[model samples]
Target chain A: MTPELPTPRVTVDADVLERNLQAMATRAAARGLALRPHAKTHKCLEIARRQVELGAAGLTVATIGEAEVFAGGGLDDLFLAYPIWPSPQRAARLRALAGRVALRVGVDSVASAEALGRAVPGLEVLVEVDSGHHRSGVQPRSAGEVAVAADRAGLRVRGVFTFPGHAYGPGRQRPAATEEAAALTEAADAVTAAGLDAGVRSGGSTPTATFTGVAAAPGAQGAPTSPGTPTSPGALTEMRPGVYVFGDAQQLELGTCDWTEVALTVASTVVSRSGPKVILDAGSKVLGADHQSWTTGFGRLLDHPDARITALSEHHATVLFPDGAPVPSLGEVLRVVPNHVCATVNLADELLVLSEGTQVDRWPVAARGANT
Target chain B: MTPELPTPRVTVDADVLERNLQAMATRAAARGLALRPHAKTHKCLEIARRQVELGAAGLTVATIGEAEVFAGGGLDDLFLAYPIWPSPQRAARLRALAGRVALRVGVDSVASAEALGRAVPGLEVLVEVDSGHHRSGVQPRSAGEVAVAADRAGLRVRGVFTFPGHAYGPGRQRPAATEEAAALTEAADAVTAAGLDAGVRSGGSTPTATFTGVAAAPGAQGAPTSPGTPTSPGALTEMRPGVYVFGDAQQLELGTCDWTEVALTVASTVVSRSGPKVILDAGSKVLGADHQSWTTGFGRLLDHPDARITALSEHHATVLFPDGAPVPSLGEVLRVVPNHVCATVNLADELLVLSEGTQVDRWPVAARGANT
Candidate 1:
């Protein structure tokens, strides 16, 4: 075979991707929750369209530029789930987005709320609450303050939102999801207490949003799903989980997904091998250098699940095969699942969509480099 | 006054960049070595042109895509410093690149050398030797085997090259450079013994290429330069260092350059703040998610060096300001120096060149996303 595909390129197993999309969509619909999957994960128009076709309410973006890309792709509803500090240029873009689509922005500070209000009057704003991530957002009790400020500045307060990013580590997803629900409930109460309608209470992450009955199982490393511990209905009305469509090593490590559920992988070629140590053409430039503290390695080989990518240079990934495992021959193609799928997807300009081991289409990462 | 320029963009100080270019060129010339700075650091055609103008013999690239882009930009001399396992598609591109420019590819195994030789006849190949980095490259003792194999496969064994990447950690540059020299010497000896002229002995890194006798200074964490430890003449004829033109936090920590010598920074706007914790609009998407063990933080604020970035999200950089230190106000613009400049540059689409606070030009990262 003349090499299945070019190495160091992002590839999505079409069958697995469709299955994941259906699973998440079915779960959300069953829960009676609006599924506005975060588009920052794939940044592809085709994926976003597929998401909407699967009953997604809208899309959540990270930057105004992402909002612009999705809007240009005819995505009319966008929620920038970031406390964006809009410069004059960005403020103009926000204004344009507000005029063109149903835009909702997150606000956690009085200054940001005022600036966003001034940038686009009557813009829908969600008061972000600290649901244990502690990265952004305000205290759940302080959501009212941000809501009042946004209201005073002529902005509309929709409700509250939080990211359970703390749900990422091993044995942490259950409590993190519980905390996410409780924080959203507290923030919703705070919004109502501030004399504002808390209509949209959003809380989720890939780990928390896909809870099944795996958490309480024997020998499980704390699954997202545990019997009778499902997130109480009405705890949050909407969910936003970015990485569910294409799981990663972090998700696998957290028991959020099985090996068969991984949709995205980098098709790489073995260029050189020294005994048991094999090097691939895919490296940090393609796989991205996103190593969480809990990740086993830079990435893992899909074909040989036991092999670990011990290190990465700009254009080379050093993989160490497990004891007695077969070493990949030079010129062999291997599928690699990166540690963080979101960052890995961000590295690619386009994704090669594969169905049954054949490339079907190329989807442009439309929102790539939309940092500003 | 209007904002100087857009926030969350990479900006290069024109003067500092020039100084950096001149400084490296002068050092390489003084040592009678040819400088082929790796273009993967900037991936900018303008910077490559400037390096060529400053007496650089050629540009080194990490990918064939980068080679194609730089070659298209009219830089004819290119060396892809990668052990590429070219698929049929890449082999065609490689043949085209070889026809257009003086091309050299790194090879560390017989299989790759044979494959490359079959793919493109009479291609120039450099046997890559492990100079202590241990990431790629064959052992020094084994380079002759690869060289002889290349010669047997109708490939031209021009010389040997090694990347002194182990020079990256604290108190490691001098020893790493020394090992790099010894490895090159050994590989060159082996090539000569194998009846081939190892005309080019290439070895370098940003930390190893710019030795300035600063490592031994009190409280210094090992610079590239130390007393009486320079490489002997003819040990290495060519040097390839990428990050000297835009020093990063790793360089600062390694004592490669001081703060004034740093050229690139991400201009960001203060979006939200509470007490000592401040958040900037720039985050991992703009600054890149590269964190070295020795790096102080994700990045250091240029205005407030004492303030350290505590955490990074997709679009927000959480900075922790020092006690009694001045905190940036909301909407205030701050320039941040990233930890790894190479990864940071790869995250951007263009670089905003600034001269004395005035925008001069925008250079496209033309060769970006050239992973294949």
Candidate 2:
């Protein structure tokens, strides 16, 4: 359902969002994993508060800037999930944030750990291991080396973590999660061998959240087999799924979520029509230009499933309808599901919180443009 | 040159920006076309003021929200260059804006024209015609029908305009420019045949700005070729070119601009390294994800020419260096040129305006996220 608000508006169905959150929380509880949902997706404090109320152990953030936002909003526990190369100024901010909250940062190398130790000593750090996503993190075999360096530098080496980012591709979630479990096990063992806690083995993307627990259970791996409880000193204890709160086209296409569970969509109006081509005002600037190599189009029409967004400009999305399919008239509103909801939310000023197909509140994306 | 500011910060080289702006103004003036540079590129009030000082005829914006932002910033002339599908609320806003400034809106359909006519009397309208970009606008031959309908609805039919967006691809600039001229001429004739002014035949994109003038001059078509003078009531009188203010990787790869003139770049820090892959803090959230099919990669490193952005996540850009090339060390700052500068600017709250090598000022991207 579309709202009567401005076109290209980012709208969140609170009803659907509630279901999605509850479903994810329930799934994580059943899988014996502590859920620390990523704050980068919604960037709204209202959602973060709801997530906290739903029994989320804490929140996961990507940057010191994001951590500052959440911590300022009274989020007591935060995880900066990145190989954060903090500058002097940022380290000062990190020290300030650590004083206010239960803070933990990701460290992938000895240099990074040493820098953090020098700047923000006594800070807790999770050694990042490369779990098939070569974008960041060190090799699993070198986890202890980094952990020892972190501990020696006066930083508290907590545990090891990995991001199964390769699971984002179609039909790759199973393999990626399997690799994640194996790698996290090896890295955690190395950290334990280094005489550190190695407790918080954090890993999970939206696509691999389900498989993360399934692959890491007692019989599944070294992880425990309990539901609703995670006891870990050397296993995958936490899962961070950002887009699960607002299901997007990527998740829907990847079978990570269903259309009925999608809580977010861009409410756009048809601005131009040329025969079978319907132009929507919601484009890259609003819905985001995130076309994964495997996606059907730039985005998808939530209402008209058969229509494909053939092209996208800064202010226009050219949608094509199948022959004999009804075309949306000019000024007709359409809901567009973004290929990547996180990218879409980052471009918005606020998200219209809707309940029962009516706008009930306006949640400011307070952390928007906090890209320090 | 990079600035010592926050990582993932959008920085504008004032010196390079000045050169680029002056060059485009000179080129437009020499081609005898009114330069109404699209404000969607920079979105900074300071830059819009600079364009006005440089004798820009006016500013072109994509949405009424953007128009309101510029107008509120003391700009009086604005063209909402889209098939504006105004709701009752937006129509009132448009009426208010039309009363305050010299405003013109694009209308490509009879229904939209009638809506505008009913809601905003005497609003000047430009009928949009398709010029090979099948995304929006009507067929050039049917421009008269839309114009006549607009006239019958009591809206002022100003002229016809088209966007040769096909020029964005490689080796298509010439053909796109030629087609733009022919389409504008035919559409202008059709508008004239419908007893309208047909004065503002506006057309131009970053890639086709130069060719637009070259292909439409008197000997080339119906346009006159007097440098720094545009006499128009029937030809391609105005060219609205965005992205010329900030040279991007797309413009660089398309040979539309030289690397030396690139003004805006994201100042990022190398945060993680895995063998040959170095990850930067600036990812799609900072630089924007606008990868044209013909481009080399997501973006380019301004200083390290051999490095390419291999993959982009919300908070990380995986960069790869050529064999034997030095990889950026942890915390080492780098400048990344975005693939689409407009998309990048919209993601930031402010632009670090730099002169020489230091940040002289910070200009707010006032119209950022104004995508309504």
- How well does model 1 score by local distance difference test? 0.86
Q: Give the 10-residue window scoring lowest on summed lDDT in candidate 1 chain A.
A: A212-221
lDDT of each: 0.86, 0.88
Candidate 2, A1-372: lDDT as tens digits = 443567888989999999989988998888788999999999999999999899999999988888999999999999988988868888889999999999999999999999989999999999999899887888888999999999999999989888899998889997788788778888888889978888888998999987776764455455545552222222578899999999898898899998898899998999888678889999899988999889999888888888898899999998999999989888898999999999999998899988988888999997887777
DockQ of 1: 0.60
Instruction: Output the lDDT of residue A328, model 1.
Output: 85
Ten-residue segment with the worst summed lDDT in candidate 2 chain B?
Answer: B226-235
What are the per-residue Cα lDDT tens digits for candidate 1 across A295-330?
Answer: 888988877889999988778899999889889898
* Candidate 1 chain B least-lDDT 10 residues: B212-221
What docking class should model 1 receive? medium
**B-chain TM-score for every candidate:** 0.93, 0.94
lDDT score of residue B92 within candidate 2: 86
| Clash pairs detected, candidate 2 | B29-B228
Give one digit per residue, the lDDT tens place, for model 2 in B249-268: 99999999888989999989
